[model samples]
Target: MGMNSVNTNAGAMIALQNLNTTNKDLGVTQARINTGLKIANAKDNGAIWAIAQNQRAESTSLNAVVSSLQRGQSVADVAMSAGSAISDILVQMKEKVLAATEAGLTTASKQALSDEYTALRNQIDTIANNATFDGVNLISSTTVNSASIKAIANADASATIDIAHANLSKTNTAIAATLSGLTGTVSAGDVTKLETAIQNVSSQLSKLGTGAKALDTHLTNVMKLQDTLDAGVGNLVDADLAKESAKLQALQTKQQLGVQALSIANQSSGILLGLFR
Candidate 1:
């Protein structure tokens, strides 16, 4: 009985050790699931985890660039919106002038009409001045928003994405003043100067339109690159829960068998001790 009791104690100890081992393994598997990541730390998959970290940094930077691009687009859109209103005013002014030329209109009526046109032109200038986002006036500043951003990697894997131009020409208040003087002042030289200002505005609008288009195309590309980077990051660190779950079951089975084997060993020790009788 004594020998058998010794065998049972030995078997219990062995069984306890196996239980501890399986408990540790299950704990690790559970951690993987809770975190939703495969390489939870560098110790898991050193090389791949490191690469995944670098990709995350790159993704963060790309997100910043996307924000900048969005602001720039808003500025361009404001300009386009203001331009439409200004164009309508200009058309009205041209009609009024034609009507005055055909009929014998009072000078006061013409002057009043001219004053309203001037006011409308000034309003356009105000719109351009105020169209800003996060303190960066894309329409009014000379700062180049079109920058090339590279993905973060061990070796600079240069993937150049050129952002859209800021369309900075709308900041000039002088153009508004010059264009406004065209209808109200009514001098031969003033008419010529005003026509020249109108032409200048037209040219600027053309350039800005082109810049807006460029930025739009770049924005689309940025979104595509973002998606690609996300996929790569997922590949590096994302866990496979299905596989891990299967492994957990297998380990549990083995742990149970180990306990049975240990119990048998302890019983053998008990039998040997019986010889003392």
Candidate 2:
């Protein structure tokens, strides 16, 4: 317990220990600054890290849901566009049929009206058959059996939104048959059939519009949820750069002071040589 023993300098030992602790703390602050994360890994805070990781997974899964919803929206949009075109053509066909019904019409004039009506009718089938998006057709006869576009609605894939199909091409066949052999005339029945077809197309368009709207609304919600989850994860793991920067400056100063203190403790042993002199 001598105050000035060269072999057992307690003061020096205590100073070295304090300096080592300061170095350790400085290293931790530097790491936080470098990574911009207070909890960069499980070693930082195992429980909080685990929770953030789980939330990150959910956010990633929501990306898939957004993609599915977007694809469904595109399919619905294409179908609705084609349905609207068909509706317009149906109106034109009705006009032709009505004109053909007029009295004292010349044979040539009747044939001309019938030809225009048939062409418009054919266009409806063409548009419906071609209305496809990402290989999904909501208004095509080929997809009538499957008859719906389905999209994932949630991160867990537990929920879904389905947009039903409308087979305009197949329905057009009835109109075609009704007006067959219309070289010089159109019957009252043909006009009635065309009117019904036009109404059906309108209803189908309304349904498609609703389904597209659902997709848009759901996509927006999912995006918002992803943003919120991302913010939550950030709260759990992200570092406060401003705080860490301040801590780093303070620790650096403390480390320098610790080195100076240790040096002073070592020099204290040199004072014993002065007594011998």
Candidate 3:
């Protein structure tokens, strides 16, 4: 430990330790700048990295939920559009029935009105059968109960938004069969049935509109939640580029100073040899 002893160089050991410390700090700063992440791995910050990983997984699962909701919304929209079209046809059929009920109508006119009425009723059945989206027909009895669409709200699949099926088929006796068997000889009963069919169609429309709105609201909320999750992950792992850049410059200067100090320390042993001479 003597100042002039060549056996042990304390100044050189101290300088070498400082240089190693500066190199380690420089490596850390360079890694942060290169990766753009303060906690790129669990080694950087184990608890924060684990939390960010879980949030990222949740965000990915929510994307799947959004996709399912979108598909369900599309099917609902198709069914609603078909229901509206059928309602318009029913109104026309009602007008034709009223015309046929007039006292002085000829047989030919009554037959013509009956044919038109039958055609309109058939069109309603056709619309119900064809109101499909992605092979899912909400208005068809065959497909209505086949599957219920659900939107997963969590990564664990414990929470969800359920969308029920709507069956408007003639065979289901929901809305399509309400206007069945109407001919040109319109009875008071036939007019009553037509009124009831109109009301049923209107009710179905309201239900569909409500379901669509609920889906839209759910989608909006899920999207907002996804944004929040992404922000949380960023807060946990993302690096500050400006801060890292400044730190890198400072570490580089410190490394150069360490090298100079180590060089000066190594020359101390040479100075001892000179003293002996």
Q: What do the candidate models score in CA lDDT, each in turn?
A: 0.60, 0.84, 0.79
What ranges in model 1 sit over 4 Å off?
1-24, 138-199
- Give the alpha carbon lDDT tens digit for every residue of 65-94 in model 2: 999999998888888888888888888888
Query: Where does candidate 3 clash, by residue pair?
Result: none
Clashes per model (N, Cα, C within 3 A): 3, 0, 0
Best by TM-score: 2
Higher-TM-score candidate of 2 and 3: 2
Per-model TM-score on C-alpha atoms = 0.71, 0.93, 0.89
Candidate 3 segments whose C-alpha is farther than 4 A from its true place: 143-148, 172-184
lDDT of 1 by residue, 20-72 (tens): 88878877888877887888789998999899888888776777667666666
Give me the displacement of residue 216 in model 1, in angstroms: 2.6
Q: Ranking by lDDT, best first?
A: 2, 3, 1
Error of 1 at 155 (Å): 13
lDDT of 3 by residue, 1-277 (tens): 3656778889899999999999998898888889989999999989989999999999998888888778878878888899899889878877876777688888877778888887887887789888888877766667443344565655677877666666565664544444454343566666666777778778867887887788889888889999999998998899899998998889899899999999999898887666556
- Model 3 scores a TM of 0.89
